[model samples]
Target: MRILLAAAGLVLVYAGIVSLVSPGEPAASPQPWGFGTGVAVRPPEVSLSGGLYFKTYLWARGGGGVLYLRCYVYSRYEGGTWLPTPEEYPVLGVYSVTVGRGPFTEGGALNLTLPLMGGCVPVATPSVDGLQLGSIKVLAPGANLAASRIGLYVAYAGGRLGEVTSFYGPGDLPPSPEDLSLPPGQAGVLLALARNITAGCGDVSCKVERIKEFLKGFTYDGTMDAPWPHIPPGVDPLMWFLQNKRGVCVHFATAFVMLARASGVHARLVVGYMSDGPVPTQWSLTAFSPHAWAEYYQPGVGWIGVEATPPMGVTPPAAPLPRETPTPVATTPEAPPASPGPYQWPSIGLGVFLPLAGVAAAALVGGALFKKRVVIAVGEALRVGAPRGFWVYVNRRRVGRAPVEIVFDKPGLYLVAAGPFVRVVRVVDYRSMAGRAFEKLLKKLKLPPSATPREVAERFPQYREVALLVEKLRFGLRANKEDYRRLKEMI
Candidate 1:
């Protein structure tokens, strides 16, 4: 009894300390990391990222077969202006996003280069009840498998797409996340264009509409292999695209993200396939199908996705030819690309190295650190895969089966057994900073300590469904998938 009491007291102390130390770190929406899903957000020098998915099956002439899936993900905008990935940024001065490897996770894995070193992308599998399942088996005849077929599937968070379409600026705009500061000349051109494109538009929504409409003019060239741009070899492609005025999805999306960021709107470039495309009854995909887009962040709501390129099956007219200009070498003068958008092409990012050391770098002037170092969340549950499911046990006794959900409030012994082996589990809670965000939202809504569903619905009609679910959660109705869906929408 004495030992058990002492253990409980320590756990309580630990939780208190975590609550105090981890409260203010910024965290955006729950974006599951992906293979090939990264971006290079250097102000005038940026690069995009992209990925493709494939699966193949092998068959023998006489009897059997085998199947395999391939996931290829790359996060760099190859051939962009070359900037070395800095080994480390000053921690205190510049908010850092540290990407660390997690525990013995399974499935298709690959080693990536510097820019891609965030987290592994989540691949999809046949799943139920938020659980993913896969397996492998061996057969006697290995080489006999000659005749083979392949399948291709694009894994994406479909739920993320619709969320982007509904952009709701907060009634009371909160602070925007940390972001890259644009050079003065660069900021001038971007803000001028935003003002012109969003002219007569009273609000953010109108501004976004005008900007999207203006961007659609770039058109989907579908010519990914076309030479990037005629600017000096080191100039950013989108900057060239801005002056030349034509490109594929990558060019359009990249330009939109940069413009949005410069216009005081926080944004990011996302690279993934069009998972919701129409395909043949048989599993298939094409090289021309890889795609990219942009998402801008809202204060309390999170990142919202939007399309800057034209919809599929709609191709625009060809681009106008750019005037000939001498190539710039070692600062020797050369006329810039043709079709300039607004300002004269300012010599923004060319060899202009801002000294990032001493008080200058230590000041953390333009850097924005919006994301937190990834951390494990308490009460998070994961399923152990099994054919007929597996048994869940507690304190040496069987409690239930594989999908047996458990949220440990205090330290305890737990187990997940599959056939002959039993994996012992030690349960503990990991604190996170999201609770502070929710509290801010609540305070913004001006609700009391015990806000009723009616009062909540009245305050936030947009989240009437969420308000109802909160009431249900209060009454001990376990939060389900629907609750999570609602939370994503409301938050």
Candidate 2:
């Protein structure tokens, strides 16, 4: 009875600890388009929720560094939202030579396999001479949306993948009015800020440079709330970012376009993935790689790409202030929104786990001491009987006669019988205990119960060693008990 009570107490303690630390399951986002497959047609509208999508693969032989996979280009800015002009030309049977200027330096072909997460098909090529559509049916220069499974025969120059720049030709029409449109209500402040940043700029190129430099000074924080969900309802996201000066790629790119347009430089917001490091022969791109940037039109050279977002971990110089004070614009009286600090998953886990760990250690140690006392008491009681032909059985398996000592390789409750006496003994292994606790941690992270060790490692790269240990135990492989002890203390 005493042994059973001790085991039950330990179980209850673990249950309470789990209840305290585990978080409710996160709500899953709706995915209208199938994941990891190509789509036949573009969707009418798409929403951004900042959730991760399926992975896409790209295979390329040549060129590297910030491969600009051109997707959608938004020319119109209505407040905080961007809209593309309604103009698409058919380029189904046209050869690459007849497009903008001719083919750029022929580099190699790039094969892209995309999942059906969004409407636009991202196309990256080294050719800056023309908008190479390959066999794609429709081409929207203003919006650049296309069907999936896009293939481009890229042409290279200086080992950099060229963007879709040829469409904005020297003799082509000027930028649309929509490209220069500023957000309502905040137009005055935006124009004033733009003029202030570009005070010494002599031409459009100089103004573009000034705007890019100013935005680079702001911090790049991806943990903040999505742009659409600004605090104090109905506040423009761009205005909020300008006030805070810290945001993700979208915030930085949108601000750049707005500032450039206000300064009479025709610019558009481009959404795509930026392959930052060295490009391997085959690259696997995840949803985490989605990025946004700005492009401004230069008369003779066409639209040139400008990276405004500061590189990760590089502290840029302080943003320049206006040389002279401008007229004040009336604003709301609401308090400024707070900046969301760096990613906090690691800190949050530590904060919740530390206290519970202390309590768990106490409970486990108490259980172990009580278990040792019970075992000694049972041995004494069995030895005094001194009956002939005495026998002992564990879990219905007959082991030996009197004074039997049995060993268990795993942790669990087992039935032991000695002659007429029968009792339940619970075996405990610290390694197994830690493994169960790790599983509970996985559940708190919203991973599926059957998630594989590899999947868990992918989600939390920091816990990779723990995942490997768990994998060994699950698959009946040889696992180091000492390794578990060291890792537990480290964690």
Candidate 3:
């Protein structure tokens, strides 16, 4: 009976080992871009969940208190959405331009180079200044350039000494029809608010100032609970913000643009980083520096920057050294793939199969050793005959006379004695104990009963260590008392 029970346990252990070590099926290939045929790719919805966008390195001498690095410009506002110009729009391309070589030396020149971090083309300075442009590459007419670095020369009027400033030069393009576009659903609300805010304002500048002052009343909160909150179905996001009076920089900037457009002004939304303060040579800007502001088109004066968002009072921490080094201008040949050798398959098979075979062999050897120890103990207990009328006792409970056979249904430490002989033995069924613990863990985590170790690890990364230990124990791998104790603590 003991041998039969041991054989059954071994079979269960072997089955678990095979299941745990078997390779899984290959994953399906990813879906192709734009889905299938004839499907229109939707533009990614804008997220105001602000995060680090990119880093900018600036070398400047003197400029205005604030420096702007412009990235994406949106002119079309539909409902509450701001859309950028089509990719087919024409853009000015420049190969290279040198500064400080010519006689033009009045205001300080800013030498700026930032990597192409995203899809948007970044301009270092406002294009209205007529600054020297350099190393600006464009792919075809309207396609964005896939360049490593974009370099630009910005000339700004000298202001305070020791003040390092960078500027965003949005190309000098006249306002398009899209700039004056207003939200269809919220047009009436926006126009009414714009009129009420700029009631006594005479000129465009006065109206813009009035709108900026009006926006200061709204609370500035960088943390957004949802991308578009308080917006009911069919209601515009801008309308919701106007009613709620709370949002981040994007909300403030969008509101200002809509109000300006409704008041018969050509205004657009600019997304970029705003850096200011005194720097002897250079300072670093990080993801925390991303901001959005408004730009209104003024006749003869060109596009003027407007700050409608209240002060966020956030200062970007100085970066630890430069994150990336400038790549050298060079081209290299691609290397050919290596050919598989004749013995590759056999070597790979041996490499994977050997470890599994070793684990099985070790498990069998350990089980045999334990069985031998049990046999020796049983022999000793039977050989020592009890006195006349003497009986056997296990934990103070009498079973029978001397030379009796004892079998434990559960695994644990036990005390056996008969007549003048006494013995202590520990019986452990590692596989069963591990199975129960793993099942309990799955229940605690609310995972399905069919959840595998790999799935559990992937789903709850915090339980990765426990999952690995359980996998080993479930497969009858060698685990000491300490290992089981640790597993219990983890679960």
Among these predictions, the greatest TM-score belongs to 2
**lDDT, candidate 1, 1-491, per-residue tens:** 64454445445423432332212323224332332233221111234322111111111011011111212111223354212122211111011111222221222211111001111112221111111112211111101110001111122111111101000111222222433334344567777877777667655456656777888676454442442333455565656677767766667766776676666676555443332222222322111123455656555454455667766412222222111112111111122111113223222221121111111222222232111122212234434444246554332234455555443322233333333333445443211122222334557776432233444566678867765555433211132344544554677
Model 2 regions more than 4 Å off: 1-57, 89-101, 106-109, 115-117, 125-173, 223-232, 280-288, 313-491
TM-score of each: 0.32, 0.44, 0.43
- Where is the poorest 10-residue window by lDDT in model 3? 328-337
Candidate 1 residue-wise lDDT at 181: 38
Sorted by TM-score (best first), the order is 2, 3, 1
Highest lDDT: give the candidate number: 3
Q: Residues 1-491, candidate 2: write the lDDT tens digits.
A: 66566556556644543432221323222223221232123211111212222223233333543355555566666655664444531122211212333324333223321121232334453322232223212221212222322221111111111122222122233466777888778889989999899998879878977887897778776532342333354667778889888777777788988899899888777665544343443422211245666777777655666666777712222222212112111111122111113322222244433333333445455554222212211001123122345665444345567564454433344444454444445444443444455557656787533344555666789877876665443322223456556656645
Report the lDDT of model 2 for residue 373. Answer: 16
* lDDT, each prediction: 0.34, 0.46, 0.48
Candidate with more favorable, higher TM-score: 1 or 2: 2
Please list the residue runs of candidate 1 whose C-alpha ends up more than 4 Å from where it truly belongs after superposition: 1-180, 183-185, 224-234, 279-288, 312-491
Sliding window of 10 residues with minimal summed lDDT for model 2: 153-162
How much is 452 displaced in model 2, in angstroms? Answer: 27
Per-residue lDDT tens digits for candidate 3, residues 383-459, read 32455455654443456666555544224444444444444444565545665687688689886433445556778
Cα error of candidate 1 at position 138, Å? 25
Instruction: Estimate the lDDT of model 3.
Output: 0.48
